[model samples]
Target: MIAPPSPVPDSKISLWTPFTFSLFRAIWIASLVSNIGTWMQNVAGVWLVTILTTSTLLVALMQTATSLPSFLLSVPAGALADLTDRRRMLLFTQGFMACMATLLGTLTLMGNISALGVLSFTFLLGMGAALNGPVWQTITPELIPRPVLPFALTLNGVSINVARAVGPAIGGVIISYFSPGYVFLLNGVSFLGTWIVIYSWKRKVAVSSVPAENFIGALRAGVRYVQYSPAIYAILIRAFSFSFGASAMWALLSIVVARRLQLDSSAYGVMLSWLGAGAVSGAFTTGIINRRFTVNQRVLIAIVIFTGTNLSLAFFPAAYWLYPVMFLSGMAWLMIMTSFNTTVQLNLPKWVQARVLSIYMLVFQGGMALGSVTWGTLADHFSLWIALVAAAVWLLLSAFLAIPFPISPAENLNLTPAEHWPEPTVQGDIDPDDGPVVVMVEYMVKVADIPAFRQAVDQLVRLRLRDGALRAGVFTDVTNPSRITEFFYVATWGEHQRQHHRFTKEDLAIETRVIHFHTGSVPPRVTHYIAFPKAPNVDIAPPFENMEGQS
Candidate 1:
């Protein structure tokens, strides 16, 4: 017999706990090398655009090209990740990006690269990243236990920032001595490590009785989940708002270094490194931040720091002062991003994990894409300072949004699948496609408890709608004043079955509370009905017309 799993550790767990898992450690190291190469390419690509054109719009367009695919494709990609074998999907995307990076390098070396060509290649790479993102995010749970997931995400941030700290600086040195072609080539080669790691791993496949969801249906389910989840949508709003305002620095940093500070590409790389270094520092402190403050408070602090960084770029524009400010900016980015990521991850169950994450990717990247163009246009028409100042002001205003959409912590939630719903009894082998399925639960509530019952059932209504109910309602019997019934409709027999798997301990608790108000002699009665079948060749007579007492 298999040994029982170890008990989960406490809240004060070390930040490095995830590294104890060898698979996680191996994957993390491989991903680090790949991320470094990607960062190097990012530095080279952005600087190359500056060399090709003086137009601020063209330069900012580079950032847009990188973000736009994710904005457009993340939802579909999420659905695909959930529906397909994620390991294979990740392998394909990594290989695709490696080839694209190689081709870009070759083109640059041939002296045939243009502004549009660079942007086009960047867009292709962005598509690969877009496809890779959701699968990559969802894989952490497989690598380590849930208790360590938050820190694992923090460590993921560390990998990116450590690469950020090291990559741009190294890319700068390479560019100073050689051509960007070499940097691109190195990036192409870097994917080998991660590609090999993923290929070597043996992934466990889960066996389930429920059939896999179709693409369109999976997409709809994900969208529906987000529609009713207030905590999640609040996180999305904050993510979009933060990225929208703060993207100015990323979109225009090259121009700021070249035009305002009169610094070389090497200095530009150094500035980015400082930002990365600060982020690396911040990653270690996230555990402390989590212990010390709420998610909303952490995000608020990050916004304040980021606003300061933008204001410094707008007003100071001095190299001496900016080194530290950029460092602070990195820390701010790490704090807020990890907080959003961790909260979202903790709140999701295994089934919908990738799909919802893809939605998060859509909002986060969508915000950056739109914001880049907005800030770039402002810079092109007016001045860089005006753009920076405007962005800083907007970021400051984003802090107030927290008041209305405060983040709810996921620490207390029990997201493990409840699987408590009993199998619905049926007379025949019901086709999964048969629908629409109607579910009714009869409850006996006395007049004295109707108000309390209604209030509790109201919460139940949201729970039903959130987990796949197409429509739901509460009704009272006209002849029997004390008899009340709650009804809901699912789109298909299969969907109703899937909904059985969607409930968590938290959801069951809400439902249990609603059930507590029932005054019936027996437990609430549940009944299921399917839509009447139509026979094309035969005429059907109504059963009620043949009743014995019928007139």
Candidate 2:
């Protein structure tokens, strides 16, 4: 046996490529102006409500109005991104937002603004945000290649944190010297710069042609894809849980510092800056700390660290300690979020990358919306510290609870197939007589177990085929040296149902070799079918055996 020397990787193949940096710069600049405006509006709006209304409910409700759109609109928006040109769609949304911002600025400047007007505008902004949020995430993969995709996403977080730090600080001063009305005006103007830059890009993003009429059908496909993929589902769950549990501070942080810590609004802004600073640092550190970790591993670690660090803030006693706590919280959160972004971009096929990412944005942001309302209510009733503490606990609890769904490789059911596995009939619009139904399910398996698991998983696939069940099954994306996703290809409703209903000693035998070598990973969430158009008509009955009834 000959021992082979390890080959050295090319240094020129560095993660920070020119294209990524350019796109990053453009997006960063755009986000910078927009984010500052966003933060300014956020701070001023919440403060205005707290000052004018005695009820904390009103203050919390104001926060609710801002983020609720994400919950309602993220997934559908993602499907739209897939169906249409994401860049053009973003332009429209940005215009909507700019108009809304300008309107609010005009009314505020004229001294004609009422609380109801503010609330109404808040909903309008939410509407724009909901439309924008999902598509925004999907755009990243189109901007960068696969290897440097992580770096690009990390760069994004770094940029956002920079804005988070600076925006509030500047907004505080502006609001102090001028008025919250001016923040709206500044934000409105900022949109034009981004719009111009995007419009001016020499090369336009090119994607496959999608028909205008297939909008509803495309949406159903994306949703069906999500439902069938356990890895994707787990990713969404991890994201949603992480966002829902950890977002408590987003709403209450200002109130906590201003009311509880007895700090001025400027000081509160400074503290937020510190948090953003931590987040930026965290993003940079991930590039170094994460040597060869898979995206899922990094995501899991980030969530744990972010949740843990934020919890520390709740227990800290001194006001001076607040800075350190907020900073660490930001840092850890940056790691988790950047990891999540990179994972989604890397795993999804270019064809539907934006669409899946958009769904991700919806679930997570919607979680944020609910978290704001829930934590805000809790903070109003209980002590701010108690609310923060509870949020941390929920975050911690969620990590463990969410681990079982095959989000990462560390959990049980660690097995990966050599090829894409077949799933049941998932695509609703397509009939059984059409083509095969495809569903990708990610799983983690030990490196040693992969060979045996391949056979084991194959047996499972063949069982469905013999029963006249699964049409096709293959491995799609392997998470690392250890984990892989088995994409199932089953055709029709009968085969789909049959695969789930019957498993005997014969079916169990193949798993033995697979399990012997297996460490463990999460089991794939079986999906019936993913919606893709093929069978347009259903009236012509083949009088095929009732596979559905028998299965």
Candidate 3:
């Protein structure tokens, strides 16, 4: 008799969910109003500072104040967010920000505000934003299911770019027509609308965690987690590059439009609008990624698309072509940012979710902050187009850096490339009898050694768990697979111990199987990770079952 077909995995991630749409709409509204104020404040603030101090250093310092909180305290706040009620935390932050904005407006109306006063209020706003940033991210998955989590994340990006494009024009108009203080009042009032919506809502999941008692200990823990992780580290570096290389353009874009393109304010506004349209288009386009390519391929594609866009911006002939070029660049930005964010959500565990996000913010937007200042300085000396060209060259260089490390995308037991696999995913402080942490590492391994390596890997797993600190195992490939494709896998340890830790030499024997097994005539290419899903089901694998109480 013919055998029945094996069960196929369920794979339908909704692109259009009510929860997703509501969250997107709410955030877009919030951003549109507040960002308009923010942009107006940014433009007016810088110009105000320039008029007051007549010093670029003073203006630079003012801009830096806006981003300082993210650099200084996102980690601790992230740990705090993971420990407390995220929504409640956000409520407090939002309310505080409104008060700060109101005060700034009040001072401006009284004509009593100074550079120092501006700095104080801006720093307060940054503090609230640091708290809001982590919550904004980690809270989303709780609202929408995992399947649509990516869609929601992409939508989140769409809202930000829309704000980036539109907020400035409105800000400029309001500031020019009335005074800048009116813009601040608009932001203060806008918070009430968001607050009402949040209060009326009911959540489907509890998006809170027990606070880590040792605050510094928790901070160190977050750092060490990425330090030991290859895939996580690689992604972090990619974010850093994007921030440093590509993001500098934002600072110079206004200058380019004003001087290089010799465009008037209205023309600049039109050009900016094209960016939002491009980003929205790119956001929707990524839904097909699951159907067409692996995560690595999408990453590579994002890099190429962004790099090409930047190159076009660097070489555009006339001011007329600027709109079309900026539009495509916006699209490219969405593709890169969304794909990277999805990778973060796909690869992390709930326990460390906020911490990873904190790091992502530190690297990505932090890099932008760094780039902005750098570009501003560059523009004072060089022309804006020269600055844009310099930034474009750096963008191309960063993408090329990623080409060497291509993490394979086969979700299985052994995900790392053969030689460079880190063993913590298999045997570490984490409890294995409980389950595996699915880490994604990108490295290189050889093609010819597939057969013998598979045999050795099978041998390692069959061996009983080692009694020492390292307890390791490996699963062989179901298919021989591509010659040099990136691999993804699930690695299990019974528990992740947070207290004091120790390891013995006995842990090394079986743990080294994947590295040593590739004995072919040539070396193999590979990359791997030990991933921790945001919400892990302990029952799916009995190993994770016993781990519930250990940590």
Q: Which pairs of residues collide in candidate 1?
A: none
Off by over 4 Å in 1: 1-8, 43-64, 103-121, 172-182, 252-266, 380-383, 534-539, 542-551
Q: Which runs in model 2 stand beyond 4 Å of their true positions? A: 1-23, 44-59, 202-213, 248-267, 292-300, 307-311, 369-390, 401-403, 406-551
The TM-score, computed over Cα atoms with residue i paired to residue i, of candidate 2 is 0.69
Q: Rank the candidates by lDDT, best first.
A: 1, 2, 3
Point out the higher-scoring one by lDDT: 2 or 3: 2
User: How displaced is residue 142 in candidate 1, in Å?
Assistant: 2.1
lDDT of 1 by residue, 1-551 (tens): 21222435775477888887777888999999999999899989998888988888888898788877888788899999988889899999999999999999999999989888889999999999989999999998777776777788999999988887788778988999999989999999898789998988778767778866889999999999999899889999999999999899898888899999999988887888888888888877877888899999999998888788788888884888899999889988888888999899888888889999999988887788789889999999999999999999999999999889999988778887789889976766678887898999999888898998899998888878888999998999999868999999998889999988888888988889888888877899999888767212335667875776876
How would the candidate models be sorted by TM-score, starting from the highest?
Answer: 1, 2, 3
The lDDT of each candidate is 0.88, 0.65, 0.62
lDDT of 1: 0.88
lDDT at residue 193 of model 2 (Cα atoms): 73
Provide the lDDT at 52 for model 3: 58
Write down the RMSD of candidate 2 (Cα, Å).
Answer: 11.0
* Top TM-score prediction, candidate number: 1
